[model samples]
Target: MQNQGLLKELIQSLCCLPGVGPKSAQRMAFHLLQRNRDGGMQLSKMLARAVNEIGHCRECRTLTETELCEVCANPLRDAETLCVVESPADVWVIDQATTFKGKYFVLHGRLSPLDGIGPDQLGFELLEQRMATGQIKELILATNSTVEGQATAHFIGEVAGKFNIRATRIAHGVPMGGELEFIDSGTLAHAFNGRREF
Candidate 1:
């Protein structure tokens, strides 16, 4: 079945969102047109505003409307210990999960040379500059457990070592309450390597 021009355009645009396929986009378009026009309009306006105004924080590289993010602006946060993450979303997760008191540095992406992403693309230069300031005493690498993430963490660790700053990777292992049988080999290995006396 062929949709009218505007409806088709709307569905197509919705499909641009990650994990949204044509059918889901069509359902969303229909839902917006038939049941929730007000909500849809609000979403559209907010999307436009965010797209136009939101930008990376200069210090941490997280999304923000101003030069620095709220975390970077707050004076009470621990400036001597920085948590390095793969993206802004990780920052939010860490904030929600732990009682961590440090500032953050968002890489925005992991190292992927095949896709041409490298230190420059991941904002390593800015990170180095921050390290050179002698304000950060330690770096906590919270990058993902993927190959690229590990490689990125190693690269950052080497860079931190050059500046005489300590760096550590977040522990990867079987999650709390997870059975050993269900855990992957890599995670099990990491768990063994990161093990400490109980």
Candidate 2:
């Protein structure tokens, strides 16, 4: 309980990650100290390296090591179809589910008013810019069904309307208030297949 200086800083920094509470962070810190010193050091090094190397894809706003992510750079992927998601993690979940030939646009966050997150913060402006190119034929709204996620999807629908692009929201299958990241690949694939128009 009396952790100070470097140990306290490490625990506090670990708590910054989502779902990592003080207790969990403390456990993680101690785990690193006691058992996984080398792994912990590598993790720290990777985190620092990624912080320097990975950045948002200029086109879709997903995290990338370069100007564009793999999906954007892939010649085989359909550039005209765009899947919009709340974060880079959602993009990965969907990708793992298989055969989404279209590219993706990652919002990096959702519209949570309680936390003061809004459309601007979710990068709707960048999406509008992408749509303005007129090459995108469809925009898939894969945001979750939580209040904030739904709000974000609706906002995207409005933006899509201005560009005359077809907008669809991935169906609710996992559960109400559930997140895409936690859903199994099978369920996620079904949701993607069963998507409906906004």
Candidate 3:
């Protein structure tokens, strides 16, 4: 019924999260209600605060509560090398997994015309402004290995060319411990084509 109470409303609201189907939402909602209402309340408060306070960093467009994100704010970070990624989460993941000491630019998404996402939506103008500042000597395209990601990187590379900035793509190939026999043909081809002297 449209007039279902708070319990139903809570379950429906929980379904808004990614990968959270109705069953998952229901389970979560019931778990919170039955066993951990206090934890749920705490989570609710934190989530509310994060959503309400978090805003994009002025320079990199990553989610931050301040004018600049930690990376952009750090003076020790390399201003000459900027990594372009598809999401704020990518910035976090790359920082955690790699030794990249350069800055980052979060695109939030790739160029997908069918979904109506374009350069404007991804804040290409802001990126161009950063490039125009003449500080970025190299742009590292760390976007996903999908077709749209490649197209986005290509478009950004062309933009970098206009500013005379060097652009490089992060390699997408076999994992460090992946066996050649088990690796897929596409990955093998990419790795073989991208091979360099030992």
- Alpha carbon lDDT of each predicted model: 0.95, 0.89, 0.96
Off by over 4 Å in 1: none
- Which of candidates 1 and 3 is the stronger one according to lDDT? 3
Lowest summed lDDT across 10 adjacent residues in model 3 is found at 1-10
* Preferred candidate (TM-score higher): 1 or 2: 1
Better of 1 and 2 by lDDT: 1
Q: What is the Cα-based TM-score of model 3?
A: 0.93
Name model 2 segments beyond 4 Å from true: 1-9, 112-116, 173-198
For model 3, the local distance difference test gives 0.96
Q: Candidate 3: list runs displaced more than 4 Å.
A: 1-4
**What TM-score would every model get versus the actual structure?**
0.95, 0.75, 0.93
Write candidate 2's Cα lDDT for 81-109 as tens digits.
Answer: 99999889999999998678999998888
How well does model 2 score by local distance difference test?
0.89
Q: What is residue 170's positional error in candidate 1, in angstroms?
A: 0.7
Pairs that collide, model 3: none
